[model samples]
Target chain A: MPAHSFRLLSLGIGIVKLLRSSDWLIVPGVLLLAFFFVAPTVEIALSSIFDEGLTGKHFERFATKGAYVEVFRRTLVRSVWIGILCVLIGYPIAYFIVHRSLRTQVFLMLLILVPLWTSILIRTYAWMVVLGREGIVNNALIWLGLIDKPLRMMFTTGAVYVAMIQILLPIAVIACYSAMTEIDRTLPRAAKVLGASPWKAFRHVFLPLSLEGALTSFVIVFMLSMGFFITPALVGGRKDAMLANVIAHNVEQLNWGFASALALLLLVATIIVIVVVRLLANRFVGVRSVGMAP
Target chain B: MSRKMGNPGSILLTAYTVAAIVFLFFPILIVIPMSFSGERFLGFPPKTLGLRWYMNYFSDANWIELTLRSLRVGLGSSILASVLGTLTALALARSQIPFKKAITALFAAPVVVPTVIIALGVFIFAVRSRINDSELTLIAAHATIALPFVVMIVGAAARQVDPTYEKAARVLGAGPVKAFYYTTFRALMPAVISAAIFSFFVSFDELIIALFVMSENHTLPIRIWSDLRFELDPTIAAISTLLIVFTTAAMIVADRLRRRSARKPDA
Candidate 1:
């Protein structure tokens, strides 16, 4: 054989030897993700910018259009609000569960997980039943002579918040509960023994330790709320459309470039928020550790 | 420390927890009885209860077909995810591969990224490649999301497994593959099974990707979505009830398997 063919044959043998190695187990997964996940992400980013050979028009339209900007603003603001609500409600539940006996804790966690594992669609459907005009709440109010007409509870911002909060509350509780469990149970008792009142012991010791987990839960809920498509689309009114809803609509319209732009925006915003939160958390944790040092 | 049972603060906290639990479960509680409503409409208290809607669901061909489609997609994606994820886990836990952290992060990227964004990317890829409306494309898309769960669960299990057992097998004249298959693989079976179950549900319960990619055929969630959009009937309530039951059963099984695996002795 010629030298070129011999070199090619040697390279083929080397490649086969590499694949036969145990370390090459990652090859199949990496290939799958590279094709499906990384390639498509790159495709989306490229498509967003390279419509008819590298134009900024798609993003420009998003920035210039008042309605689109409003949708983006609403998505961010609503997600933050939902995140706050989840933390407010979920923190107490987490605290309660953590304070319970082991058996009780297990039972409570099972309750939380059952709903967490249920489909978002089913949960949203249940909300529709409860909040609809002829639904449970309105029926109860009318039966009690509280109102002559059925209240239009469905397809409103309040409905959206209620449904979203209920859907995400379990996640917040789980995050906080897991964090709280990691705390040394004797710390608060030690604080009390150090002459701090019960509230002060909780406030000064227990609260700070669990705060990181609560923040994590908030961030998770916020990120999820930003990309919420089904719950908002199903229960939310016209004015309550999120960015994900708009992207879905644009995709259906066969406006791939515009949809990709919106998706890129959502992805970037989520990443920025997560990175900022991580930095803040690291600093807070660093400060706490330093303060606790003897 | 336990709170004093007679304290006003303790009583208030108890009440608050009770109320929160009620709020969390209220929607789920409402769905079951509404599923049994004898009337055409969905009302609370579900007057004149019967299995009218459940019967409707059982007899409907479209619902049945979509359900079967969901099962096939779920099974296909879960098996793919489990196999790939197990191999990836073994590589990360046992091998001296470079950039281990980055590779693990890459495997987990799907979970962090929003489903809608991934759905759009995959949707565009499918349409551009002329692969939309195919089961394989949908299965691949579902597997992408399910990959994270399998990797996380099985990776944790693989890490806990002592390397000595496999190394001992290697020293006893077994081939590397046989060493792993006999020692580590047997120990990892329960975890892999649980992870696969979780992966199956991840795909089964998924909707946004299915909705975006599927045009001619529909998965169960897609069917539920359209029915929700175009109509409001007791049939959806029935379907929701059934899904809740299925999810609960699967969760129980997964939890039991996970616990068993956690309790297993080292090989």
Candidate 2:
């Protein structure tokens, strides 16, 4: 054999030897993800821009269309609000949970975890049951003689916000709780011992320590809220459709190119949000702890 | 700690937390009771209490079939994700793999990437490949989402097992495979099982992917979604209650397994 052929043969043999190594254990997973996850994602990105020969019409439509722009705006606005609300509600609960006895802590944590593990669809449905015309709140109002007729709470933006927040709150709590756990519980007490009031200690010492976790939870919730489908579709009015609902509608209508374009927009927006949040957090919050797991 | 009981601030905090907990569980609390309603329409303080909706769920062939379909998909995807995830975890934890962080992120990307994006991508991919609306395709899609959880859970467990045990097994005449299987794999079984259960639920509870992919065969969530869209009936409440119970039981089992494994001494 010639030198070049011998080199090629050696390379092929080297490949075989590498495959037989323990490192090959990851090959099946990488291949599976590549085929199903990476390939489809690339296909979407490609099809978005390359429908029958590199057309920009799909993206152009999204840019020019007021309705699509409105949906995108609403999705971002709602996601931001939901993220803020989750952190607001979740931070207190996490603080409360972290300060409890070990047994009480376990019990409190289970309360959060149970809801976390439950299906989002079911949780959203539960909101439907509670927020419907003849649902619990309306019924209770009438029974209390506060209203003569049922309130139309379902199929409204408020319903969407409430359901979304409820669904995403457990995640926020878990994130906050984990982060709070990392902070020395006695830090606040140490501040108190140094003559600061309890509120002051929490505001100055504990708050800063756990802020990163709160920010992380906010980002997670915001990203998830951006992709919400079942809740908004079930609870929101016709005007309240999010980007995901619109994408789903388009996909159902067999407008693959448009749907992929919208998906690309969502993907880009999510990445930007994550990256921006990390940069801001690092800059303002003074870099996350090195030991923190992503 | 001593001041907690009497302090006004602590009392206020306790009140707020209790209210928050109630808010967290509000839907679950309402749905369980409404599931027992005998009325055809959804109403709170259900006038006539009975098992009519529960009976409706059991007797409906469509619901039963969809439930079974969901189970099949869940089982298929969980098994696939668990096997692949376990191997990947072992490789990451035990081997000197290059680009470990990037590889881990690749596996974990499914969890962070919006499901809507994944659904669209999978839908387009399936249509292009002419594998749309198939159980196998659905399983693969579901497995992609479940892959992250399995990797995180099992990978964490794998890292905790002392490498010395496996090395000791190899030194004692066991082959590499046997060494791992006997020493490390056995120790990792609980984590694997729990991860599998969690992945099963991930598929079980998934809807967006199924909605995009399946038209002929509806999964349980798809059926529920349609019912929710068109009607507000107690049957959905019944189904929701059942799902809650099932999920709670599974969570308890998974938690127990995790705790038991956590308590085991490293060899």
Q: What lDDT does the true structure give each of the candidates?
A: 0.89, 0.89
Measured by TM-score, the strongest candidate is: 2
Rate residue A118 of model 2 by lDDT.
83
Query: Which stretches of candidate 2 lie above 4 Å from their native place?
Result: A1-21, A287-294, B1-3, B259-267
Looking at model 2 chain B, which ten-residue stretch has the lowest summed lDDT? Answer: B258-267
Summarize candidate 1's per-residue lDDT along A1-294 as a digit string, tens digits: 699999999889777766876778888888888877998898799889997688999999999999999999999889989998999999998998899888888888888878888889999999998998888899889999999999998899999999999999999999999999999999999999999999999888999899899999999999899899999999989998999999999988999999999999999988888888889989998898798788
Evaluate every candidate with DockQ and list the scores.
Answer: 0.69, 0.72
Candidate 1 residue-wise lDDT, B114-175, digit = tens = 99999999988888899988889988888888888888888878877888998999999999
**Can you give the TM-score per candidate against the true fold?**
0.94, 0.94
Q: Across residues A47-116, which tens digit of lDDT does each residue of candidate 2 receive?
A: 8999779899999999999999999999988898999999999999998888888778888888888877
Across all candidates, the chain A TM-score values are 0.90, 0.91
Which clashing pairs does model 2 show? none
Clashing pairs in 1: none
User: How high is the DockQ of candidate 2?
Assistant: 0.72
